[model samples]
Target: MPYTVTIGREREMAEVRALLERRGDRLISLVGPGGIGKSRLAIEIAHASADLFPDGRYFLPLEGVFEPGLLLPTIAYVLGIRDNGEAALEERIARALAGRRVLLVLDNFEQIVEAAPLLVRLFDVAPEATFLVTSRTVLRIRGERVYEVDALPVPDEAARGGERAMRSAAVALFVDRAQAVKPGFALTDENAAAVADICRALDGMPLAIELAAAKMRVLTPQAIAQRLEQSLPLLTAAARDVPERHRTMRAAIEWSVSLLPDEQRALLEDLGVFARQFSLEAVEALGAGRAWDGQALDGIAALVDGSLVKQTEIGGRPVLSLLAVVREYALGRLREHGEAGRMRAAHAGHYSALVARVAPGLRGAGQGDAVVELGMELPNLRAAVRHLVHIGRLDDAGDFAWRLLVYWWIAGFFGEVRVWMLELLGKDQPITPHTRAVAWFFALWSELWQRPTEEVVAGLGECVRLFGESGDRDAAAMATAARATARLQLPLPDLATAERELAEAVEELHELGNAWAEAITEVSRGRLAWLHGRTDDAQARFDRATEVAEASGDLFTLSVAGNHQARLQLVRGEVDAAEAGCVRTLLVSIRLHFEEGIAYGLEGLCAVAAARGDGERAGMLAAAADAIRQRVGVFDAEAFTVHTPQLDAMREAAPAAVAAGERRGAELTVAEAIAIALPDEERDRIAPALAQW
Candidate 1:
């Protein structure tokens, strides 16, 4: 048996055993695509069916064999049958198993499929011997029962829940492999969806999943999911024991592609234009002007049969997509052939037009459906933006960014959009003044919580001036509110200027009927009020912000206001109310995938714990907040300063408890931290499994 634990093959194992037990089924072949665990499953079946072959069991790997004539010699070598110059190799091997119940396992027979006919000669000589073979292609000889091995079962939407995700075979295998590299790694609520996404993105192939999980030694599951856009280079193995072909995902995929015909190979590379799933009509559009001789349907069927392109159904229509690893390999071929630029342009143009049609629904009554629709197409959308920016289509890129603003904000993709905007602005090309201003505003908005130096404040001021001159009153007002907030955070706070600008911006936004902008500006007003020590005024501002956010369906802003209000509650000695508010905010933030909001929620809960004199809990929550802040590369110096006194007091009162708590919390995932922060009754009711961690 292999050293690594085998995951989830109960059905295949039972079927293989039943076939082997049948009177005529003496030779059983396990067939599947490369890296689909055909070899691993064969080993498992052989180990489990040991009792039937009590005389002898032998394993031979034929991966290095290239000529058909060398098959008998290789088998005789493995069985330790020497050429004594008296009998032929095959006759000697047959004599060794003539009258005994023996089992022979042949691994990696695809490299020498021509030698498959030799298996019948040995079976004819030995009456009671059973042969088990693993190959990517089926051996269509007599008495050979083929067992098709598929990829592990991946988690779907319903199985994305923390506990249900763990039960999925793909996710379980990833966790098991990840633990082999980083022993402390575990699947938790915070990373369950990302882990499931990783499994699905790899198409649940065992070798690919193992290659991805090995990255846990340096990257988080969320980070791995994000980096999978170019997964080939990131998913490589350094272990010396594994075979060379299995050491990298690309190597394994390339081996399979090497076996395809020239025309089918070209079709596979051409299909790389699609970033994700595509219908038959979509693929036909890609082949419209190409010089391929065969039909697109025929080529797709060949690739599907070869396991290079997977065919699935969505909404009663068949769709096709390449596994992330295979797609990356195909894309490399596209780039090598100099067709990537042309194909990428067509892909970008199609998605850009599609987003234009869907932009309006993002803010209308069909917002929920729109969000789900856009989420499913996020990869294609991202690819389009990158292509546009790369080709210096600045105006189009800016238009696309602005059109998807609401979706980006709601889906917690502010950082990604910020990078795209910065890249677009970096190109020294002419763009509309309004486009430039909007780009600058978004690029600066993502870093609003960082220490606002003079340079940052100056940039925001420029955005405000350009927005006003461009005749966009709503944008101008939003920029003004942002500039005010940054000005207040300066080394020497400009209270007079901040207060005046915020009032004007809020009044203008409200008059313009922009509920989302109004609500966000109101939160800034509350922060200013808090600085002025007018606690009642601050509470009223936050209440108004929350009310407007709820009415406008802005959960991100609602979480922001809730966390601020919870901080005030802690200051008022209302620990229970503060704790409840923090829990509510955390739940909303988790749903939105808003990391910054989650960090704030943790900080607020830390204050509540400190007020209750639970120093350990307070220290743990504070450390977890720090971890999130560090990962996202965001820091609020002012907020950290405000919490310093409470943290210092906890440390001074119970140094040992605080230190131990910090150690434990530094190891917690967001889900684990939330588990500890939840109220006792609720934590026990909802996440009893995580309590121990």
Candidate 2:
């Protein structure tokens, strides 16, 4: 759990600590080429500055977080901030860190530079908190201090056996790791020259040196140095145009990987399909087991021994990952073998299975766990969907995309998913009627916010027809409920017709024993009653819907009903209970990664805050909800009509305060919005980051 054994970073560590401690550099990013030990150096600095940051010192790995939207939540997750559906996560984190001194380390931030603004805002809001980051490049945020981490110092070619030769930082590191495998392995009179040559040849990169030294258990230093001399340049020729250090690192990876047997080499290359960490079972399920002839364990062991793979534990489960440079190298090699397409297909198939396996739990008590799992696998899933779409594999792509509808909606990934769904639908490839129905459903769901009522209604009609024709009675019933809800939002709402339609849908859902569907219909009915001034009837409907949703373990429906129930409570002047209900639903929505739920909850909280005469807080909640609605392309026109008059009156009373609140809310991420909505009495439910560690 302590720092990895680093030999030559003492000076770098001291300088980094000074930058963070003495100089008051709120954002200090360690920038360097891949495999140059930037992450290791950052870790070392965090350990050294442990005492300076009295509040907390936490490390958040961003390698698993590929989407910019996830940045705030990922940070909150590491900080142990639980979202209460009422407050935004950004506000929660900022509130938690206000006037507090803490050290937050974000690693592998290169791919998520779009989130730099979020980091900057955090710096502004939490002035006392310091941020340490490790990336291949610097974040160009103002006031950022870039620390360049370079390779270690290597011994000269003519250096002979002595303390002086061993004193070179690179030589020292190589010797240290070499001794781990070959006990007592030292730069003796016989091999000191070859050891020095090996370090210099590896360009003093710690990773390359460690990998080369791993081979010392079998080969002599002279032979290892000879192999590097022969293979590095030839293998790295394609990358000659890259930076010299980068080229050197890639060459080292190429040389190390080349030493594996044919099967191990093949497996290593194919493993490049994974975006981040992966499990052994995923590897086998992805077809690597068949590729390796069931020798996956042996193949993985060989890669681990060769230092081509790094093994770590996540959630008590072992995960294998390749260093960034190594993965890139393997991907290039895999492409050269003309196996890219096949490997991608296999990757897509495996993730499809993963989605299918977890889909059953998305609406159950395991919804939270399901969301977490899907979040972990999101990057790969995105890649799979993209690949299938690009290759015109419409059936597989449509199926995969449709299966993630709940996930996409819950996680606020509707915008990205909408693009893919539209692209797939526009393609000329033929798809099954079932797939078509699912696609149409997603198309309507995603475009509902931005599209016109007529267009959306037509899409809904087609979706209903397709579901009906596919012999999926429950699905058809669900679609019917959706159509009825949309109709209620029309300018001249048809209360009688919509109510009848919802009733029929509910009956069908009940007959099918589909609690989730029936719960959705009940909420629609409740909304209709509430709109018609039937408060008691609406409350009863909401209660029944919540009961059914709970029994079915359907967080989506539960949260939806809770949203309406909170609105009804607000109307009845139960301010505290309304706020409590809003917070409860927000937490469930946040847990489910459902953006629509979070947005709706925030709106409810906004209305409650307005009813309480807290105009500023109300404005902030409304703005937060608007931001989420814009991001996810979803909006409830009726809800807006209901709340707007009151919020506008509150906003007019304190234009400046309300505007400030709105600005802050607009800056908030979904997690932060949820946190801000949380009442003080509910803070205990937010998990502490320490619990995760």
Best by lDDT: 2
Decoy 1 TM-score against native: 0.55
Instruction: List ranges where model 1 is wrong by over 4 Å.
Output: 1-270, 276-302, 310-346, 353-378, 390-392, 406-419, 446-451, 635-643, 680-693
> What would the per-residue lDDT of candidate 1 be over residues 255-324, giving only the tens digit for each residue?
4465467777887887787765776666666675665444788888767655567777754557787754
* Candidates' C-alpha lDDT: 0.75, 0.78
> Pairing residues by index, what is the TM-score of model 2?
0.73
What's the lDDT for residue 69 in model 1? 57
For candidate 2, the 10 contiguous residues with the lowest summed lDDT are: 80-89
Over the stretch 385-433, how does candidate 2's per-residue lDDT look in tens digits? 8778767787888878766666665665554555566678888678877
The all-Cα superposition gives candidate 2 an RMSD in Å to the true structure of 7.2
Kindly report which residue stretches of model 2 are placed more than 4 angstroms away from their true locations once superposed: 1-3, 10-32, 42-148, 158-162, 183-192, 236-243, 288-291, 422-462, 465-476, 487-498, 559-693
- Best candidate per TM-score, number? 2
